[model samples]
Structures are given as C-alpha cells and as structure tokens.
Target: MFGDMMNMMGKLKETQKKVEETKKRLDSVLVDETSSDNKLKVTLTANRTIKSVEIDDELLEDKEQLKDYLILTLNKAIEKATKINEAELAATAKEGMPNIPGMDMFK
Candidate 1:
C-alpha cells in the first residue's frame, strides 16, 4: 500500500510538470489571421489576446468602407484565433490525459 501511494504521488508530480510545460508552450504560440483580400490582418496570442492589427494603405481611400472592413476583418480574425486555440487546447489536453475520461472538461 505504501508503494502504491508513492507511485501515485510520483505520477501526480509528473502530471503537474507536464501541465506547466503545456502552459508555457501555449503562451508562446501565436496565430495570425487575415482577410481574403489581404487588406486587413490580425495577430493573436494563444491565450486569445489581440497582439496587433494591420490594414493596407489602399483601404484608406474610403473611410467608411475601411471602417467596415476593419471591423469585419477583426471579427473574422478573432473567430479564427478562437478556433485555433480550442484545437490546440484540445490536443494538449488529450496528450496529457489520454486515458482519463472527461479530461478536456477541466481545460
């Protein structure tokens, strides 16, 4: 019984280490999304924070249109970023807990 307890404690420590490594890797990941026309772009961190946005000079000619395009582009970029983050998180969670049921729910 004592050996079993020690083995479980070791496994828990290993899992904790893996979780920390995954967090660090996720923090370092970045996702970039752009509009179809390339007039607008957005960079997002793995945690889904907007890092930056860019707009082409040609779009500046029409202020109203530029504004609309920017909004649309930003929304699309955010959506893309969200999907990427979700996929990555799912993958990481699966890798960390392959045999555990409902493991991703904690993520």
Candidate 2:
C-alpha cells in the first residue's frame, strides 16, 4: 500500500509539472483576427488575453460604426481564442486521463 501511494505521488507530481508547462505554452500562443473589410483587428492570446487592437483610419469618421466593428472583431478574436483554449484544455487534461480514447488530437 505504501509503495502504491509513493507511485501515485510521483505521477501526481509529473502531472502537475505538465500542467505548468502547458500553461506556459498556452500563454505563448497568439491569435490575430480581423473583421471583414479591414474595419477592425484584434490580437489575443489563446488564454484570451488581448494583446492589442487596431482600427482603420477610415473607421474614425463614424464612432458608432467603429464601436460596432470593434465589438464584433473583439468577439471574433475571443471566440477564436476560446476554441484554442478548449483545444489546449483537452490536450492538457488528457495528460492526466490517459484512458480516454479519442484524445489523440489533444496529445
């Protein structure tokens, strides 16, 4: 029983290390999404951190349109980031759940 416990502890430590490394990898992932017609652009990390935003100079003429386009583009970027994060979660979680069969993509 003690030996089993020791083995479990080692596996848990390895899992923890993998989790930390995956987090770092996810932090480094960046996705840039742009609105159609070049109205707005957003740069974000897979973890949904917005790195920057860009607006076309032409959009400055209309605050309302700019606002709408900005919101739309922001949502698009975050949506893409959310998908990436989900994939990352699946990949990361699979490390701890090796019995799952269809998680090969995550691996």
Candidate 3:
C-alpha cells in the first residue's frame, strides 16, 4: 500500500512538471481575432497575453467605436485563448493521471 502511494505521488509530481512545461509552450501559441467589419484585429497567446492590436485608420476617428471594437475583439480572442489553455492543461493532467478506481467520472 505504501509503495502504491509513493508511486502515485511520483506520478503526480511528473504531471505537475508536464503541466508547467505545457504552460510555457502555450505562451507561443497565438490566437487571432478580428472585428466583424475587419477594422480591428488582435493577437494573443494561449496564455491570454495580448501580443498585438491593429486598427484601421478609419477607426481612429471615432473613440467610442474604437473602444467597442477593442472590447469585442479582445473578448473573442480571450475566449479562444481560454479554451485552448484549459483544453491543453486538462488533457495534460488527464494523460498523466494514474489509474485510480472511481476516477472515470472526471473524464
């Protein structure tokens, strides 16, 4: 029983390491989003860090419109990045989990 516990602990440690590595890798995974009219564009990493924002000169004329475009586009980009981040981390965690009884519910 103690040996099993030790093995499980070791596996968990390995999983933690892998999850960290995956997070680092995700920093390079870019997600792009654009406004419906193509006046604004955003780029972000799977880690949800904004890398760049491009706006058409037409948008610079209207502060409110630019704000709305930024909010909508950034939200969409964030949602996409969040999905990628969660899926990747969950998959990594599940992949490294030891076969313990009654854990299938998590799947």
Candidate 4:
C-alpha cells in the first residue's frame, strides 16, 4: 500500500509539470475572429490574451459602429480561445491522470 501511494504521488507530480507545459504551449495557439462584413477582426491566444485588432477605414467614420463591431468580434474571438484552452487542458489532464479503480467512469 505504501509503494502504491508513493507511485501515485510521483504520477501526480509529473501530471502537474505536464499541465504547466501545456499552458505555456497554449500561449502560442492563436484564434482569429472577424465581423460579418469583415470590417473588424481580432486575434487572441488560447490563453485568451488579445494579440491584435484590425478595423477597416469605414468603421472609423462611426464610433458607435466601431464599438459594436469590436464587442462582437472580440467576444467571438474570446469564445473560440476559451474553447481551445479548455479542451487542450482537459485532454492533457486526462492523459496524465493515474489510473485507479473506477476512474474509468469519469473518463
């Protein structure tokens, strides 16, 4: 029993390291979103950090329209980044989990 406990602890440590590495990798994963007419675009990392925003000259004419476009496009980009971040982290965690009795049910 003691040996099994030690092994499980080691596995958990390894999993933690892998999770941190996965997070760093996610920083480079980019997600892009654009307004319907393509007047506005946004890019974000899987970490949900905004990378860039591009706006068309026409959008500059109306501040309200630009605000709306930025909100819509940025929200979409954030949603995509969140999905990617969650999925990647989940997969990494699942992959590293130590197999134990009845844990298959969670998988």
Candidate 5:
C-alpha cells in the first residue's frame, strides 16, 4: 500500500509538469476571428489575451455598430480559443492516464 501511494504521487507530479508545459504552450496559441460581415477582426491567444484588432473604416463611423461588431468578434475569438484549449487538454490527457474518466479532475 505504501508503494502504491508513492507511485501515485510520482505520477501526479509528472502529470502536473505536463499540464504546466501544456498551459505555457497554450499561452502562445493564437486564433483569429472576424465578424459575420468581415468588418471587424480580432486575434486571441488561447489564454484569452487579445493580441490584435482591425476594424473596417465604415465601422468607425458609427459607435454603436462598431461596439456591436467588436463584441461579436471578441466572442467568436474567445470561442475559438476555448476550442483550441480543449483540444490541447484532450491531447495531454491521452498520455499515461489512470484509466478513469474522472481522473483528470484530480489533476
């Protein structure tokens, strides 16, 4: 029983290391999104950092429209970032798991 505890602890540390590495890499993963009319563009990191934004000249004329487009673009950018983060996590989860569906929550 003692040996099992030590082994589990070792694996937990290893998994923690992998997760940290994955998170670091995720911080640099970028996703670009545009509004439905392609008037606004936003670039986002998987860590939810906005790296860049571009808006059409027409959008600059109307404050309300620009705000709406900016919001739409930001939301889409966040969604893209989330999907990438989930994919990276799933890939990380494929390495040396404990064969338990809920095991990752412990990490």
Candidate 6:
C-alpha cells in the first residue's frame, strides 16, 4: 500500500510537470483569423491578447458597413482564439487524467 501511494505521487508529479511545460508552449503560440470576405482580419495570441487588427480600404468606404464588418471580424477572431485556448487546456487536462472521478465537484 505504501509503495502504491508513492507511485501515485510520482505519477502526479510527472503529470504536473508536463502540464507546466504544455502551458509554456501554448503561451508562445499565436493564431490568426481573417473574415470570410477578407475585408477585416485579426491576430491573437494563445493567451487571447489581440496582436493586430487590419481593415481593407474598400471596407472603409461605407461607414456603417465598415463598423459592422469590424465588429463581426473582431468577434470571430476572439471566438477562434478562445476555442484554440480551450483545446490546449483540454488536451493538458486529458493528459493528467483520462477521466477524473468526482470531477464535477471541482466545478
């Protein structure tokens, strides 16, 4: 029983190490998302910080349309960045445990 407990502790430590490494790797990643019409675009880091925003001259011709497009594109970029970050976190969680018992308690 003592040996088993020690082994479990060792495994948990290793998993924690891996999780930290994965987070560091994810921090260095950046995702770029562009609008479908290509009139607006945004770049975001995995941590969801906006790196840059770009708007085409054609889209700026109409003020109302330009505003709408900018909002739409920004939303899309944020959503994409959120999904990517979730995926990375989920992957790390999975690596820690395939299915954690009573995991709902944490939530």
| Top model number, TM-score | 3
Q: Mind giving the per-residue lDDT tens digits that candidate 1 earns over 25-52?
A: 7667777878788888888776677888
TM-score of 6: 0.66
- State the lDDT of candidate 3 residue by residue for 1-107, as single tens digits: 99998998999999999999999999999999999899999999999999999999999999999999999999999999999999999999999998777887766
Give TM per candidate: 0.61, 0.80, 0.96, 0.94, 0.84, 0.66
RMSD of 4: 1.1
User: In model 6, what is the error at residue 23, expressed in angstroms?
Assistant: 2.0
User: By the lDDT metric, which is better: model 2 or model 5?
Assistant: 5
**Root-mean-square deviation (CA) per prediction:** 4.1, 3.9, 0.9, 1.1, 3.0, 3.9
Model 6 ranges off by over 4 Å: 58-66, 98-107
lDDT assessment of candidate 6: 0.77
lDDT of each: 0.73, 0.81, 0.96, 0.91, 0.83, 0.77
Model 5 scores a C-alpha lDDT of 0.83
- How many residue pairs clash per model? 0, 0, 0, 0, 0, 0
TM match of model 3 to true structure:
0.96
Ranking by lDDT: 3, 4, 5, 2, 6, 1
Of the candidates shown, which would achieve the greatest lDDT relative to the real structure? 3
Q: What is the RMSD of candidate 6?
A: 3.9
Question: Model 4 reaches what TM-score against the true structure?
Answer: 0.94
Candidate 1 Cα lDDT to native: 0.73
- Over 1-107, each residue of candidate 5 has an lDDT whose tens digit, in order, gives 78877877787677778878998999888899988788899998997899999889999999999998888789988988998898887677567455345666644
Better model by TM-score, 1 or 6? 6
Instruction: Give the clashing residue pairs of candidate 4, or none.
Output: none
